[model samples]
Target: MTAIEQGTAGGTLNATTARLDRLGDAVIVIAYIISVALYLRIMAQYMVGFFIPGGSPIWEPVIACASVALIIAIGIFRGFTGLDRLDRISLAAVLVLTTVLGAVLLIHDGTLVTSSTLRLPPPPPVGTLDALLILGGLVITVQGFETVRFLGDEYDAVTRVRASRVAQLVATSIYIGFVLVATPVMGLGTAAGPDSTLLNITARIAPWLALPLVISAVLSQFSAAIADTAAARGNLTGLSSWFSGPRPYLISGAAAIAIAATIPTLVLVTIASRAFAAYYAVEAVIAFRTTSGVLRKCGFALLAVLLLAITLFAQPAS
Candidate 1:
């Protein structure tokens, strides 16, 4: 072939690859949406358990089983269709919601440390076990932002950079603020207890806001689940040419739902958060190694260490 012809062919091949990548990203976004919805539905049932006089039967394992079934069905469908431009838009929407929610909480709390009025005691020593659990949980919680990478194909280089910057700012501001506000409000001692810190914080500020906060929390959790499933499916798509077929995607989605349903809502959330954090830590290390400048490398390293340290040491409010 002539040189110009060869070059033209190469360009076309690259474009095709790029288009496929974008499709995969869209599928991931769809998976995220489904997972998030299921999570919220399950959580809503759990929350109702607290207020209902007899508590609801829907909070049981049976409900979880049903959820899993639904997830699998949805995952399969999304996998079959592949990714698309609309999926990218959905992913962006999720990011925006996450950012806004984080910003709102940070502004509402107005501090980084725990609040005193929430009946919390002093925090445990920095390196103590309880401290580590709290810190670890927070780190895991914040690391959820890495889901962005799964949608890389859906974003152009500039969009990726901007999204990363926005996500980081929002995640950091809210997480740090919560840790600060929660530490004092619930005290180090109470923060180490079993109550949901997010709900507790909202309740303290305004009892009336509690229901709405709980509902929003459910929605957020569901969103995270959907994103998680989408990411998993996307990875699978890359692995198996067969996955490009409809059946495999459906099966994968079903499996995700089944697994989700089997696990307790709280346990699932905790696990998902921790897994995300661990993944983020790895990404941070990779960033550190890849950056050409010493300053950039050091900054990433510092952030990674800080995240790890917090995961290992901070206490959660009771």
Candidate 2:
């Protein structure tokens, strides 16, 4: 019998199964919390040093000011524009940045860095454990592409799917151009360790445009943060009646992030990222709870197992 059918009946086995399901959900929740804590750390170290008392990062204050102004604009405009409208505008900003980046590549003549310097040694054979460990992480580094699922509540599934598809296509085109451009320009080691890769690229190729790129990237990050916050709040609200509103998640999640900020970035991104991947795998299984038909259920069950393997075997992209 299906999960829904079991729920409809008053039977002995069903009650036990429900208890087990709750237990599994509880485990997943714990894993997700741990993963987020690590992710927050990564943001602090590699992404942006959120709290800067004072130093050489003069742009931090500029970005902060611009972010504040943008938030005010969002508040005034959101009711009229709605989330979908705002997302489209933000998406356009990202595309514009990509276009500018591409233009810089065209204008800059000659290779900036040698091909040999950028290349890494080949991995072990595919079936080998080492090869799997090395290769799997490359996939997990791009885990955020599925975040469109979170926006399902605000828009129709068809709309969300279309948006995600368009985003992927555009982003892929931009990324391909960027990789081709940046490969020859940036030395392999320097790009990997960048505090701000966008800023680094602009500085190297187009110094005059650095300020605009900085401001644009900051705004893009702001929009992404807004979307992720909404997703987290939505999930929390669905989790329990006690957390049935926005206020709880807003207050609690904010404080939790504040605490998470204290942790080291390396620890968070490397260790916690794997934990998130594992949770992503389990989430697939949970998604099948409402699915019908034995064959479809079996397929999803196998998919979950496959995801679980990837999650466990995958290494950190860094």
Candidate 3:
């Protein structure tokens, strides 16, 4: 073929590949949305008992087991998929969620007043458990870069660099903004409350916002689930390629998801939160080890320590 013709053909092939990769990423995003929706629905139904129903007994062990199982399932999946377009969508959702949360706090001006005349109990103390849950959620919310990294081979260098930068900037700004709002609105004391203070704060200030926020939370959770599931499937695909069969990996992925769904929703979320924290910690260590950069290493180390402390110490809402 002529040189010009060859170059044209190559360009077409690159475009085709990029399009396919994007399609696959979209599938993952859809799956994640489904998963999150399921989780939120379940949580909403049981929120009162799970948080603070007057006479209900706590089911900490069951909840914890479910949480661990869900996390393990997601970890296996995310680890398998690495980073991709779905991860980007998931990242965007997180950024948007954080922005809304920050806005809610800003609008409320750090106060926790409700329009209704019902008397509310004081906020809970900042026990280890509360700290862990908040910190863990924040860390996982920003861990989309890892997903991007996994899909690195599929994109050109320029695309990779641009995507990474955009994700980082958005993630950082939202997180910082959220912390600023959270600190004042749900004082450290109130933040430790059994209920999701963030959600409660929003509900109190504007009941209309609650339904939509719940919807968004559900969607975000589902997106995360899709990212996790796709990751698991991709990992299995890699393994199958090495061993010359896709069946094993396919069966494994299906089994994992099935097991996850059977577990209680609250348990799944808690476990997933803690496990993601640990996984991110390890991931940070790996990054540090490979780059040998002191600043990056320290930052990751700190994240790991913070997540671990939260997981081990966060007090369950009674």
lDDT of 1 by residue, 30-70 (tens): 43433443464455564664366344655644554555455
Candidate with top TM-score is 2
- Provide the RMSD of all predictions against the true structure, rounded to 1 decimal: 8.3, 7.0, 10.9
Tens digit of per-residue lDDT, candidate 2, span 167-277: 788767766777667654444335345323545656656777666665455445555544544454444555576765345334434443543544443434444445555
Error of 1 at 297 (Å): 5.7
Query: What stretches of model 2 exceed 4 Å from their correct place?
Result: 1-88, 106-141, 188-198, 286-306, 309-318
| Tens-place lDDT digits, model 3, residues 1-40 | 1221234346643454344334434433333333333343
Query: How far in Å is the alpha carbon of 7 misplaced in model 2?
Result: 12
Ranking by lDDT: 1, 2, 3
Clashes of each: 46, 0, 25
Give per-residue lDDT, candidate 3, residue 178.
67
> How well does candidate 1 match the true structure in TM-score terms?
0.59
Model 1 — which ten-residue stretch has the worst lDDT?
A: 1-10
Q: Which run of 10 residues does model 2 get worst, by summed lDDT?
A: 49-58
Indicate the residue-level lDDT of 181 in model 2: 70
* C-alpha root-mean-square deviation, candidate 2: 7.0
